[model samples]
Target chain A: MTPARRRTRSSAALRVLFAFAALIALTSVTAVVTHVVNTSAGLIAIRGGTESAATGDAAQVLASWTLLESMVYRSVIERDAVERFPDGTRIEFRSWLNPAFITGGYSADPTRTGVRGALIGSLWLIVIATIAAVPAGVGAAIYLQEFSAPHRLHRAMRESVHLLAGVPSVVFGLIGLVIFARLLGPLTSGAIFGVRATRVPTGRTIVSAGLTVALMTLPRIVIAAEQAIGAVAPRLRLAAFSVGATRWQVVRDHVLPQAGPEICAGAIFALTRAVGDAAAVIIVGASTVVLTDPSTPFAAFTALPVIAYQWAMRPDPSYRGLASAALLVLLLVVVVLNVAAGVVRLRARRTR
Target chain B: MTQDVGVANERVDTLSTEELTVTYDDIPVVSDVTVGFARGEVTALIGPAGSGKTSVLRALNRLHDLTPIARVHGSVRLHGKDIYDADVDAFEIRRRVGMVFETPTPFPMSIYDNVAWGARMHGRPSELDAVVEHGLRRAGLWDEVKDKLRQSALRLSAGQQQRLCIARTIAIDPDVILMDEVTAPLDPISTGKVEDLILTLRPDYAIVLATHNVQQAGRLSDRVAFFLVDESRAGRLVEWADTDSVFFAPRDARTEAYISGRAGSDMSARGRTG
Candidate 1:
């Protein structure tokens, strides 16, 4: 074949192949969307316990009720219950703050009050875990990356840390249950802190749960921190050392600041993961619900996912709505975290 | 800024090696080579690939210590003082003799920071801004990069980056400057600019450049060293002479074949006698 004609034929064939590939990609996207829609419809039907489409007024009322529920009905219902739900109902409502153990009021009623208790519990766990984990994890990573060299023991330790990161959350829960709840929790509660601490009778309290979740997430944060620290160009370190900066000075002034955003980003992601982790909390026995907030660190607590699970599994059909609402709240929190991360990334880029 | 040619006439020899041999990973590289570099003059080291031009250049500033496995035998004297003497601190040695490497490995930093790094490393001139500006001016980059001092060194074109590397090295005000294929990566015009920088800087510093470009060596160097690979594949200094004499009347057949593009033409000849 003439070189020119051969090139033309090949180019034409390539164009056809690219078109075919484009068609496949479009069809695949359509198929995925269709599958998702169908699955969601099926899930909605299962949740609703109805195959037939709702009749005219029923469909309209349900749709409008959803809107009202979001915008106004929830507030009105909450106000009415506060005014007239009875002292016993109020006390049960307050037990959510205590967890079922030392319950003052909050209960698993799937009410707005109960869901609020769950939200507070989850947020407390996430925030507390983040506070405890960030320093510990990032400190360990800094020590490993900047202070230590590759020795057999250190390498083994680093590998073990990575291994810890891969352990199942449920397994961490079990460990937390055995160690913190069964051992340290009781010791700390009975001897030192006092009656308030002992309110977590089995030692499986908010503090224990938070600590457990921190342990479960610690390895992930450390590993990511290590990676971020390691990602700093060696030239920077060399430059610092050549300028007579002390080793610690290099880390404190240059390395850590440069690694701050990445480490914090990883820690935030880990904390978000900790927020949604129900399995570990479940193992740590986070079932108690007190309507009042924990006055102390050792206080028992329940998390949103556990509460959502309890409400969602209930035989009552109305409780399903509460589960959906809780799910929506969780999604919102995750979205907020992702958006904050995006903003931070943009700022970092602009600074560089 | 041409040096007083009388500088060469005054000292005759500013730096010299006695029976220098080097090895890496137990493999012999350069062996039994004796040469001298003249004062305030450009001395070019040219040789075939793996003829140990770089290893020899690195030894001059004791930079070979940076490589854990590199071994050296022989005494290299600067102003009659053996540079490798135990009392000589490597940092002090490096401060006195600076190097610019191939590929323009500028610090991942602002252009101003890159220029000031060496000075900072050597604990010189507390006024960093002034030092940076002075270094850039000397490098002939200040006019183009004056407005972009805060910009990343990497933002500059390759030629500018190479000059930035030179500025960084000279910022510390070293007595000797080593250029290892500094212009090999530049276009002819950029190469000429660098060659001009070399010429202008000669009055203030002694230069030892290792280049594969024979014509470049002829054009810029006052003295030339020709290295030859012997049967043992170890580099040997065959001849070191005045630049014109070396290029026009090279004493060694290997040097003649090399300059004429005949000896080991397919392989990179890296040795230049300095």
Candidate 2:
């Protein structure tokens, strides 16, 4: 190749190399920061946070610390050795990510504490948000982009969607607190469903908080979904219309399916933003300490982010370590969801 | 100049317009234009850009209904019935009078579905495979896509995709087909293929095409309507006749200038105000 062409190709390769390096640096920074914070908190809890020096919990914690130290020796470690009696009945697992710490219910003791209540409640919130947000956001995006007559009101509404994105997440929480929690208290708190006691309901239910999160993420979903729909070729719509498909049919069969993957990717990102937010749910009346495994939409709930925020603020150093562990769980979930969205986008592009 | 508005006889015309006027945002784009398309014949609308060739073609298919600001002020008749009547469904009218666009438009679906989609919409699912094959065969795309019916239509070349769009349009068996510069964006070979396909379709359906390519019109059209911008900045049908008379005989000086490429240079500057 000529020198000029060779220079251009080399520059392109260098740009790609720089991009990969930047992405790797970003991931490494996050991992390193998390490790430092979690390890420092664990060390503080072990050295200064235990209430009584001679308590059985402290002794067990020390014993587990010794086993954890041995784990550093890769070639010499007991991968699975639970405490057991001579009769071989297993006593317990001695690890941070043990089943007790993942699935066990509410606990005051540090050894047996788990995220089950927060985990299940957060899942309920996701379900509620998906149900409430996807239809409204996707439908509005399609309608506004495809069917709305382009006049002053139409342009104003489209412009206001960007303004909505500019509003802080906490503002939506306040609105939800007023509208869904106070104004619609009877419906959200299940008082209308006969769960009300003699006292008035507070409306601190999963559905209310979920709706708050849904409201918080609505604009982002709309923006992303609109972009996806707009990216479709005009020729496709004309072709569908010329084939005698009705307006609804054109959107459903041609436009929607073509834009599905991008829309889903946008929804996933919007949900990721919602899933990490604690301020909104807390403002909408999530109770971190009294969290229960929500059985219905109207039940009181606490999400992982809210509980982590609460734990991280406790005076007890032990709670700090637990907070880091909770955050690690939340982090894992976010990573999995983001990866799924990437795969969806890649599959859609491949088909195109 | 000899006017051929009489060619669009009420009894003989398969598709005809009577003093059709199209306006957008209260501005007339095409004014008082009357034309007809006969069965098994090709009619070409030739004009400079922005002179409302596309707007007139869109009115024929009732596509202007999709645009909120566009209004039709004259009657469009199909099979002796006014299509713009209060009772006539625009969707049903469009089904009977299909359209193909300049850009290749294939649905984001399997090749089979693209051809079968219109038929499926009419609630006729019987013999879908046969219907798809017949449509593709007529559009000259069956042999290229037969083994890969499940492949996405977008994976085809631009020329092949254009043919796929043609197949998709014909699959529904509409009585009239409108083409707005269908081969303008294709390579020469693909353009040739599409032109040949249009000739094959001419004997089976009434075809109305809006084109800037003079040779394609000369090669394929039986009748030609020459449109120009009037002093009021609205597109008007200045000349209409058999291809030979409009091209060879003395008629309107404007049509002669356009046919001889004399008006091609600055006509577009006037067309913009239209």
Report lDDT (CA) for all predictions: 0.72, 0.81
Winner by DockQ? 2
lDDT of 2 by residue, A29-110 (tens): 9987657443422221122223332454442332233222434532232223322223223223244544556687767766
Runs of candidate 1 exceeding 4 Å displacement:
A1-108, A114-158, A174-198, A201-215, A221-275, A281-287, A294-299, A310-321, A342-352, B1-39, B48-97, B121-126, B225-245, B269-274
lDDT of 1 by residue, B1-274 (tens): 2223434246655667899888887777888778877657899998776777887888887766645578788999877789888897766777667788777777667898777766765555667888888888899999999998899887888899989888887777777888889999999899889999999888778899998788888899988988777667777788888888887898877778888888655444333222
Pairs of colliding residues, candidate 2: none
- Model 1: per-residue Cα lDDT over A146-202, one tens digit each: 777556878987999999988989999999899878888665344355665535566
In terms of docking quality, model 1 is incorrect
Docking quality band of candidate 2, CAPRI definitions:
medium
Candidate topping lDDT: 2
The DockQ value obtained for model 1 is 0.14
- Model 1 Cα shift for residue B131 (angstroms): 2.0
Candidate 1, backbone clash total: 40
Give per-residue CA lDDT, model 2, range B201-245, as digits (tens): 987788999998777888999899989888778899988888989
